[model samples]
Target chain A: MSVNTTPMPPERLLQLDDVHVHFSMREGLVRAVNGVSYHVDRGEVLGIVGESGSGKSVTARAIMRLLSKNAIEAGGRIRFRPEPGKEVEISSLPRDGRQVRELRGGHIGMIFQEPMTALSPVHSIGTQIMRTVMLHRRVGKEAARARAIELLERVQLPKPTEMIERYPHQLSGGMRQRAMIALALSCDPALLIADEPTTALDVTTEAQILELLKSLQAEMGMAIVFITHNFGVVADIADRVAVMYLGRIAETGSVDDIFYQPKHPYTRALLQSIPRLGQAPVRRLKTIPGMVPDPFNAPAGCAFHPRCAYAVPGRCDTLVPEVSLFPGDQSARCHLAGELPEEAL
Target chain B: MVGYITKRALWAIPTLVFVSFISFVIIQLPPGDYITAYAAQLRHGGEYLTEAQEAAMRQQYGLNDPILVQYWRWISNILFRGDFGHSLEWNAPVSSLIWERLGLTLAISTLSMVFTWIIAIPVGVYAATRQYSLFDYLFTVFGFLGKGIPDFLLALILMWLGFTWLNMDVGGLLSPRYESAPWTFDKVLNLLSHLWIPVVVLATGGAAGLIRVMRANMLDEMGKPYVETAYAQGLSERQVVWGYPVRVALNPFISTVGWALPALFSGDVITAVVLNLPTTGPLLLQALKMQDMYLAGSFILILSVFTVVGTLVSDVLLAWSDPRIRYA
Candidate 1:
């Protein structure tokens, strides 16, 4: 028998640089996404982690140009190098223009958080999946149906043939999520933006979905932007992690570095807040004190300064910390990050 | 689904009968009596009829019976023999007279409904999609104006325009020339020319109301997450709004179709009189005014049946369209 061989590593896919998305409200301009930058290599899973209102979702929405009318992209660019020779600036693409339409589903597919609301209740799942497949691929109905059934199987949904005929309401939450995944993968997109794909799922289902996504990435060599507030999920699936604090990227590193040696005060505080099984129950868990500042009226210098435990009096409050690269393949935005006293190892 | 329709149809019989009985009682309980009105007219026109003869006429027409008995007899006649009794004033069978007028009214109502849906759906979808734009504002203003003006006033305006400017006759279903013309293409055109005004008057307010409802529903459906999901799927904007949202939003509009039919049909009394259109609405109004109990009561009963049937048909249609809706 001839020897089997592995496929070549896929190329570097998406690079976002200094991306800033703002929303204009009555109070002021809310900087929903501020200077967020990350790159996804082919088949790499990049996780963006933060609490609610930290701009993780906004960053994803900005990438997709799915933000509301009031939202403004103030700065930076999203560059997509589709193949070896082709590259395009995603940020410059008009929202409703033909190029953006071609990019969506054809190049960059997205899976939203809530599967119940994401699938149209009126249409059957087969019709919904067939629509995207036929529209993007110019495939005939018979071939699209075969592809949709294949996708349903790839996402690990049971009874693929029968499930395709059912409505969204007929499926369970986990199954609906899987169906959404199948829809996203219908076009065989290069970059898959999963915005809290597993957030609404139960713990067991979440673990299964994560495994399925990991396996699919291995098979297809698709880059993924996995946005979530759950650090545990990031720890489980992400090759690299980006921590967002009030729209800005507070820290960026490999998963191991960010979890064990988080340098930014906000990142450290976020990790501490995850209740461990061995930790004793307390009256209140180790929550970072104070709420995230209103994005419309974000602080002048460090947005997280008010809530930071190790905040320097004037340094943290008045001067914006530059994102500085550290020694161990990590970067952080904090005035005294490198100079902090080392804890006993 | 067949079982559901059967159950609904079975339930509708009692409801229709109850409505007919109530309509009969309410129309009869009013001040004037059909026999009295007929006798007074005869006396005024120099006809010699004795009081005994009038009493005999009342007995012959079953007017001497108690209110409940008369209602029972009327309902029984309709149920068993399909008889609506004879008109005291016109001396014609109620069924034939009512049927003639009912056909005209129904034709106008059907045409108006067709026009209303054709205009309203597209305008509504456009308005909702282009919300806050100049076209939306202009259509919204027109919608409000159409709804604000009464149907009769609209008819009066059309009459004035047609009579003074175009020198068009403002009466009947067609010109006198076409009344004797053979059933040909030219006669159909003549009939349609006379049919235009009443259809427009009846349909304009309905179209305006439907557009408002359709616009609101379309807007609400557009904001739903599924719509955004459609867009995110790389489907065209047209597909997102029309393909998905329109079908979902149409449930409410479909259900409203039944109620709109009867209202549009029977609600045209004033408009009918203003245009001198010999439709059921004006006929029913004349019947009531002359206290021709059999004619008026039969017309009321027919109107009630139409209302009930309209609602039932809509409910069944909605259930058929949406699996989520059940008719238990």
Candidate 2:
């Protein structure tokens, strides 16, 4: 994908080095994202699973530098490689300057959870898509319009010519989501950040959208940073999974490693919480104790200590747990990550 | 869209009839008829008209009939014969007096409305974009001050300052020399010179209110996900703002088009009186005060027509501009 004499490796597509996003609200400084780090190789699907207030979406926004005005990337950097041998430090760019703006849809397109609100209510889906194609592709209006119809067709919308002229309100919920996906894929960004994209969709529609995204990612050969709260979605779509909790990565491993052999307490708890068909004897679903800690007054030591069932008293509360490595590149941030027995976990 | 417009227009017919009835009833709700107010005025001016003369006057003006019959006569003349009855106090046909001042009133109101928008929209946008900055704070203060100051008082101060410091002829729509002059380039120029004073006075409160409205609307729209989507499209901040939020912010502006024409006549009542401008505000005020039912009723009916027409235009524009509203 490089236009240079020397080609760089595809593994370096995107790298987050100790990313810290803090919001300075009136109450206090909220560490919404405290030192998050992950990487996405070209054409790889990385699922980030977390509950509400887990900072997964915030972390994805930090990657695109699309945080609120009160928010600041307190420290660390986001290194993005749009093409081989062309590295850009996204965290250093201004929030809305030309450089960051170029990095936005031109190189790193994003889609939100609510497709209803993501597309402009007043603008036609065609105009919304055409503007992107025209801006990034530098094409004429007619050509841009043609590309918009092509995109709508590619996303499997019937009667694309009619769809192009229709506004967001005229379309069904699922159709609007598909149109949003089309708009995001307009310029073919190397990395796509989908923040709970399927959460707002019904199950059948969500499955269709997931299938569409998977096929599109394969065809386009672009990396996807798929952020969702659904573990089931992660198992079906992701090759790799990064479980986040309380603004930090609790664990990062392959789908098999996360689902079958989770190293973190939070991940284990999460997996057990998912209702299985034959687990009727345990009729009550197991829920993680307590809630995600408030950002204004977070738990000391391990951020997840307060909610961690496997947490050791003084060791977990007094000292912060560092990342513990495991076999097959699996990693977890917990004091007793490797020491716990399989039965106990 | 054409069907929608036609439907809205048809709906306004009943609205006009209902409004006309309310206006006529309310106009007559006072102690006595126009003859009573006129005779009281004559007595105050030391010209005593006996009860017999008053009764003769009432009969001549058709004011002694049943209220409904009187209403039917007044309305039928307006609808069938294009007559607005007679202004008992002014002693002239209501149509003649209204048509003469209607042009100037429309001009002033239209100009002031335009001026209000032209100034307010940009300032509101700037304030919202640079929210909480010194410029935003300054505009906040400016908006509050503008909204708080009474239009008539502002006109008075501006007039005094114009006469004393600038030495400009400040009040009235035209110079005394051109007051009775027929339509000419010079008279038009003279009218324009005095026009800005009342326009500024009338627009001040409106612009101030609209600025805050635009700012709040823009702020709300700016927070929407579509704005972020626009930014993610690699559009410049300026493009993202103007193309997305600004258009949505202006829906309220489009809705205001329905009432704008009537506000043109009614918006400057106090300020026009203070400035002594030749507009319909004072005439409406006098017609109401003197219980000149025909003149008052005609004014309200004409305003109702303008309102109905304006609302239809506004509804069409709004539906065209916002599809969500069209469906709604």
Predicted structure with the largest DockQ when compared to the true one: 2
Provide all candidates' interface root-mean-square deviations: 1.3, 1.0
- Show where candidate 1 strays beyond 4 Å: A1-10, A277-284, A343-345, B27-73, B79-81, B165-173, B176-187, B326-328
Q: Report lDDT (Cα) of residue B290, candidate 1.
A: 76
DockQ for model 2? 0.74
lDDT of candidate 1 over A226-314, digit per residue (tens): 99989889888899999988888899999888877878878878877777666666666678899877777889789888988788888
| Tens-digit per-residue lDDT, B71-172, candidate 2 | 788778888998987788798999999988988888888888889999899999999998999988988898999999999999999999989998889898
Candidate models: Cα lDDT each? 0.84, 0.87
lDDT for B135 in candidate 1 is 95
lDDT of 1 at A41: 81
